[model samples]
Target: MVQPANKRLVTEAAIETRLTTERLVTEAAIETRLTTDAASRWGAAWASGSTSRLREFFAANTGPRVAITGAPIVGTVTVASQADASALVGKEVQGGVYINTPDLELRDFRIKGDGRYALIDFGPFASRTYIHHIEFDGQQSKDTNAGLGVSSGTGPSDLRVEWNNFHDLNDAAHTRPGSSYKYNFVHDPLVWNTAAWGAYNPAIHPHTDGFQWLRGSGEVVSRNFIEVPYKSVSATPNTNSCLIIKTDVAAIDNVTITENYLNGGTRTVMVNDGGFGLPTNISFDKNRFGPDFNDGIWQYSNASSMVFGSNTWAQTKQVVPTTNGSLGYRSAQPALDPDPLGFGCVMTNLGYGAAATWGAANDARYVRALSGGLINGIEFHVTVSSGNVSVGVYRGRGRGLTHMPYDLVATSGTVACPAAGAARIAIPETWVEPGDYLAMSCDNVTMQLLLFSGTAAPLFRPLGAATAASHPLPASAPSPASPGFRMPILVGTFV
Candidate 1:
């Protein structure tokens, strides 16, 4: 009877063990299904390639991946050693991240800062640092010193910055030579009052830029969407340019800027000589410029060996002229006019009576062409203003002559005089050659022109009676009785 009871107990124990094993298996299956569904959702979100969705995923994810919190990185974090750099991967950093390591690869991260730079690399010149798959958010910090999204130290480190989003910063990046920037979206730069931020002279302050290359060479900036809106949210031309290639620190050479979608800013692109001399081998090609700029498409000063080709306006699809250049005495006289005496020159049709001797024809001043090009418009500094005036350009009859005759070429319709300051008048395109004199005439107004007094062997304006019409100025201007006393300030936009 004892043996039979022991067998019954063993059988019941075996049945209980089987039931526990089945329950454990069912729970494991349910956990696997939940994990698979979560992974599928994550895959779909990533495949969408939407920035907002990706940001959302990063915000919600935990464990190995750091999420973007939209808050400033706590303090200055230094990734000085190789181990530190390796640990920085897949992390979200607040405040500034200073990198001083070599061959460091920083990926899958977000950096928010209120400092001079979100990420600054002080690595060796040939460190070959790679930064990608990152978001740099400036958070629109009102800190006056807040600066670029990414920047390098004094050395021109070899950096590859790609596949990143940069916004709300003073500038997207300020790179030196041997840097390549591609597949980046840079927009909505931070705007600040120049006066409030007393760093730069208030006049030229808030010099925001998309990609600024202060110096160095062998840099390639391609396939980037850089937009510096013409007006800030406060509706001001606070943004400066999309790209600025300047040799502020040292000379730059062999820089290529191509296939960029650049829009807005006061001027979309600015290539300055930087007083260090012209940047060599600067290439800008196949870039689309948006029409949202406040000033012009691009302005380059003294660039040598520059290749500007296939650049077009996005809306009109018109090719941006490579030869679009400015001509005038302003380039020569960068400072204010030293002589304050105004040349009280009256327009031809203005009732000057006896004073008509100093009228349009007599007051005409010629700008000698340094090189051959077409004049599209005229800009002049106005001292005293009067009524509406018609501006006209005339072609010189003789080369290398002081008091040569001129033939009317093109003239603008009636242009109203501004209260005071400079004015621009657009005229029909007219051609001119080297050594040719481009003279200007105005009708039906009285204004004081900027004067260059005591100019030797002056190019005198020919004295003539007031022609009935200011435009189509007399077929041949009369010869001058005396050498001109003053040189009037007038410049033309040429191409």
Candidate 2:
């Protein structure tokens, strides 16, 4: 028997479920079609064929988890009213999900702009929202800041954003808070490069940070990747950045950044105070930077207590300390010194690492000399509560056990605990050769030493007691019982 093209045989697999309620089944309900158009034709009472069709469709659907299916949404569907905000608990839409609402969750969609419009705009009052797993196409948008994804306004808090992808965007994300959490919040979004826009214009491109936070605190940014591209236009010849945290009025404080991969940009972080208020209580740990990425952190403002621990860059251009309040080219750190002094270079973080270890077991890691010079100072991200810690230098010769020669060139005084990021201690200058196998050791404390991820494998050696040995025991065989890992080590020179 020849079956009709529209006719189909009813089988057990075809029947999903039996409905108890009796209702008229319309042709649209049974139809299955693929659409390339952005807007879906939802024939409802409030959603007439008009300019506000997209907004009306959302206004009518008050379900907790409203799923927007079919083609893309064309125009801006602004969520302006309080009633509309209350209805959207978990609304799954396909792109163009703008938010002025509180406590909303937007996920699993591709959001493209309409040229000169923002795809995701968190209005002046949005709060407690979650944005994840969305790819934003920002090539069509006119400018960076205006057409950005996730532009936070005055009073939003308790937000967790992760796994979002962005490309060809000028401005990626930022916060405009009248205020700002604990470490409960995490941001791990991705940003790629594109040449859709021109090089730089002070009027058009004042700042195009991949991730900028003007206000609020207690949030964590980790595992995020950002690529900075070369621009086509320029007035001041600006370079696109990976992450920037700057503010004018509200005090920005207590944000923890860890384990981020940032490469190819003008600046990694521009901690701008803008003369409003200095940011305070910020920390950066376990981050990696590509070579020639310009200023690792361009500081416009001073911080009360900030930490740049376990971050790494190329060994050729190691980080240095500066007095002019900017980390240009090298991994120059402004937070390390409150008063300006062009004393020593402050190297940025790099290499494989390990978590901090306390107790009787001493912790040590292997470090290779990049450009051998006088070792004047060394700094490590040490966590402690009450006790004291002693740091030192050593020479070794082995891949495994007996890596370093059992002797100390210099050592720092035993310092007290509770040192957040300002634990940089000066040591007696010791000359070292390039490609030297050097090891950094610390006396046992009740804290952990944060590690950096690197190309080389980490090396560890455990001490038998809490106090560090000035000269370790020379071993013939590799110490199979030693604990090892790669971590950030800065060797500063006076010359």
Candidate 3:
């Protein structure tokens, strides 16, 4: 019997053992530094009457780096004042303040909309804004307006929406559960017999999409909690999904839907890609669809370039619409890999399915040799189609305790990455001794190697250059039985 060429073999026999004295760095550190800049805070007190003072405050202060907040404002505050909406870029309205603005951050506020109008109506154009940590209260029943609506137009792009809660919009026309649900009624009558909402006679928005992205790019909807009560809609269509991304004129691109908590009476995500063009580079990563999430993830369409990774389901089987999109669903658990997403790539003790990216583009960490051996091949998994990838091996040149420049060890020839699946690259042979800190870096190009995923606080190395910084391995290599940070590097030659 002969072992396969690419298979890994570990053995213990009568042989000399040479050990390196470098200590293992246990903390999970990436080379990229997280931003520590905080938004400037301004305070406001909610007063009785029109609270026009709040509106006046916004008209005065205008800057790119300022955040305003009101502790608690009473009454159903109506914001007709378009205070400095044009010049107020990167400004945030926070803490129970009700506002309507374009190109600004609407955060930490309580927005109330009457049955006749929208609570937050982002005009025909807006861009580069943040909407999060706010609560939208609508008329429990007979609410004809949307909780958050964006008219069909331009500039609803480059937005980061997260950690917001939407409930009590009462998105159904008439929800009466009992025999009172007259089937003979001429109009569509929604019936919900339960006591989910204290006000049960529901009249929902015409298009009850929670966050409607009519035309946008670089939009990320993540970690949001949306709860839509039972039997909410009667007649109007497209009122189901918590988030709807559609365009009759432009294509929605670079939208990432990840880590959301959607619980309601309707579908999860609705992508109508047929209107003008299909949504491209859409990614669904680790979202939770609750029992109330019905219909499916996508309503219907022929969308392409989608990556659906490891999502968790609660109390219901996952249902997705049939579409012509090149949908990539990672559902199977890989053998010997603890990742539920079944990505066969792992490099950490942290369970698999948690994927990381490395290279000059996403610069995270390094792959160092644990023993004295010949470097042979590099194996990795990719998600994109075909592209040129340059793989480089570097040895750290230490100068005192500070992180140092890299010395080239071996570089793989230009390799072709597949549209999907495993990629193996044979590198020019090289030797490595124990305690040598080596790094495997990819060129800043299309496609990235899937790294072991985890939530550990990352360690950072100071590159000291304008574009410097990288992950360093331990000064010493551990026993094969006690490997630390099992990165996706899996090929080494026995010396």
Which candidate has the highest lDDT of all? 1
Off by over 4 Å in 1: 1-73, 123-126, 142-145, 193-205, 232-235, 303-305, 323-495
The weakest ten consecutive residues by lDDT in model 3 span: 176-185
Q: All candidates' lDDT scores?
A: 0.58, 0.46, 0.38
* TM-score to native of every candidate shown: 0.50, 0.44, 0.37
RMSD per candidate (Å) reads: 20.8, 20.3, 28.9
Task: Tell me the spans in candidate 2 whose CA falls farther than 4 Å from its real position.
Answer: 1-69, 79-95, 176-202, 229-240, 295-300, 303-305, 314-495
Error of 3 at 321 (Å): 9.9
lDDT of 1 at 417: 58
What order do you get sorting by TM-score, best first? 1, 2, 3
Candidate 3: TM-score?
Answer: 0.37
Kindly list the per-residue Cα lDDT of model 3 for residues 1-495, writing each as its tens digit: 546542333222212121111111211121011111111111231121111222222223211222434353444343434343322223232212334344565544444444434444443344444544444455343444433322222324444443334444533111100101000001111223235534444454333545555555665554334433122121223236566666755667777766555543355566777476877777877665533233344554654646677665422224333333222221111122122343333222233443444334423244443333334455566755444554434343333333333433454544555456676666544333332333443334355455553324332332211121222222111111111132344334312
Q: Which candidate, 1 or 3, has the higher lDDT?
A: 1
List ranges where model 3 is wrong by over 4 Å: 1-103, 123-126, 141-156, 170-207, 229-239, 303-305, 315-495
Assess candidate 1 and give its TM-score to the true structure.
0.50
